[model samples]
Target: MDLATLMSKGLVGPLTAPPAREASFPYGLDKHGLHEIAEAAYGDRAAATGFLLAAAPRPPRRTILLWVTQASTARDMGRVPEAALREATGGKARRLSLVTRHATDALWAVEEAVVSGVVSHVIAEVDSADFTATRRLTLASERHGVPVTLLLPHICEGATAATTRWRVGPQPSAPNRYDPRAPGHARWRVHLERCRAAPALVGQAFDLEWNDETLSLNMVPGMVTGSPAPGEAPPHPGFPNRRTG
Candidate 1:
């Protein structure tokens, strides 16, 4: 065929390809967004809190972190220890604690903190949040470029506008390498109930260990059982205990 004829025929169009999507373990939680971590059980609030502290992205030095807690949640779960916060953030960040009388007030404080543009991060412990409340927080977080993490009770359900929702519970602690009798790294079972950033990852569960020494959250294939006796052989790694939904 003549070149002019082929050109006129429009044999081919410009090649095009869709952009590849980037994925993170906790989805966009470490980034600038509004995410929720809910307890898998009545007493799993502590586990959810620990997971938040371990998994949240560390902020810049001397930055402020506004931690807002509802009165009920504070009374039930207690406040996070200073030493734990120091280890979690490497003592580079400061925390400003706020106690709200009600969930609505707590949510309001969280959104205000995000919009104020003063704190580097925000963590709020509330009874629950509906779609409208979460939507407001998400918008504020996006507009201000600050990340907000919500710690919700096990009863949290139904619609939510958060970028991700994680159901967290305590897992068997990893065996201590040096002292078998001592507690090892803290572990948790994290289930992704909802994810806007990576919907495909929803319903997936992970076994995570928080290594204080390394200050990192790591996923493990299996968890070791209880420590061995003085002369007993070391226990082998096996599947973690599974919880029914």
Candidate 2:
């Protein structure tokens, strides 16, 4: 079934045939699936990169990062740079081998890796992608039982071969229970723009709070709904005002 339509109707499940593949792990990252990451804030690409790095899985086998840059630029693709990855993984990026290339070569390399069956996960940061390329990768990744994640820039729109497309935008600060004066790591309001695998989760904008300690994300339910403790204020700016006289 088409992901966009299924997600719109709230009928979410596994994308492929009924094997009940895992959609998401304990961490907020999807499993055996594809998800989109957009700017949390207007231009906070670094935050987006951090979110992905935090969520990236480091398998014992291999985690391939195909960092794609402009066709002509000699500059580095700083989205998932070595330094940032090192910080995110606590200096364990040595576990993950890296590949940097221009978009043209990167696309071909991704296809090659999908068919090789040697890597556990493939992550690509590309300038743009069409449905055909996405579909090709999707099929190959599924056949190889390897998950693929596409990291596109702000202009990531139109059709895709991904299982779910999420518009991850920044949210208001998460009140630090322990340190009232300090901001928590980060929080995101994820709009499940499309969900081919688990369509029931589509249109279900999950307010996710990431815990750096556990390296996992949990669904913060109260942010969307007005339900809160008695005499307590509703959290988040988008929630309705609880101050009924």
Candidate 3:
């Protein structure tokens, strides 16, 4: 008998097809499958990358992260500060960095890591990727059940096979609660450009906040006249390493 017939006869537990996409969290960033972040011209690509790293669901223990970047990105944007990464991950996850001269090589490394099953996650920063490249990465991610995030520049245009595409740019942070002059919590003006999971959500823009204290990403209301922006955090500075003399 066919599997459906067997199920009707109670010979097997009820069979159901898997979901086309993973269950998404509040914002689209937590998507378990592949994700892509494309920055606008002169956009703060580093911040978007860092947010993805910080916002990613903490991976299981004993697996490290694979980070691939193009040489130009490294030279122009510079690498993420170790202190910043440590804070973003809550000091639990470790990362392996791989710098490639070409965007293709960087993308290749991302795919290899996704299918290797050695690392828990793969995050790549490249200038651009074509549809074929993204499609391959998506298949590998689904097959391996691993998550991969690609950070691209504004130049990265055209169609793609990624699960979601977010156009991220810096936005004015909320007014500081403690020190009004100081910058408040990290905020971004985000556009959910494309989504295979929730296509209807596309075209809408969201003001997002990265809460470092809780290490969570939240969608807050946009700024309004004469009012503190949403998702403002208490002002604080980086902790010192040693006691003051």
- lDDT tens string, model 1, 97-164? 99999899999999889989999999999888889899888777876778899999999999998988
Q: For candidate 2, what is the lDDT?
A: 0.60
Rank candidates by lDDT, best first: 1, 3, 2
Most accurate candidate by TM-score:
1
* Ranking 2 against 3 by TM-score, winner: 3
Instruction: List the lowest-lDDT window of 10 residues for candidate 3.
Output: 10-19
Candidate 3, residues 1-245: lDDT per residue as tens digits? 79898657644442143325643542435545678888855757866875686567675455687889899999988887767877787777788999999999998888888878788778888888898888778777766667788888878778998888888887766667778767777787777888887887887777777777788777776433124545555566897568778
State each model's CA lDDT, in order.
0.84, 0.60, 0.75
- Per-model TM-score, in order, reads 0.82, 0.68, 0.80
lDDT, model 3? 0.75
**Which stretches in model 3 have alpha-carbon errors above 4 Å?**
1-20, 23-28, 60-62, 223-245
lDDT minimum window of 10 residues, candidate 2: 225-234
Q: Any idea what lDDT model 1 has?
A: 0.84
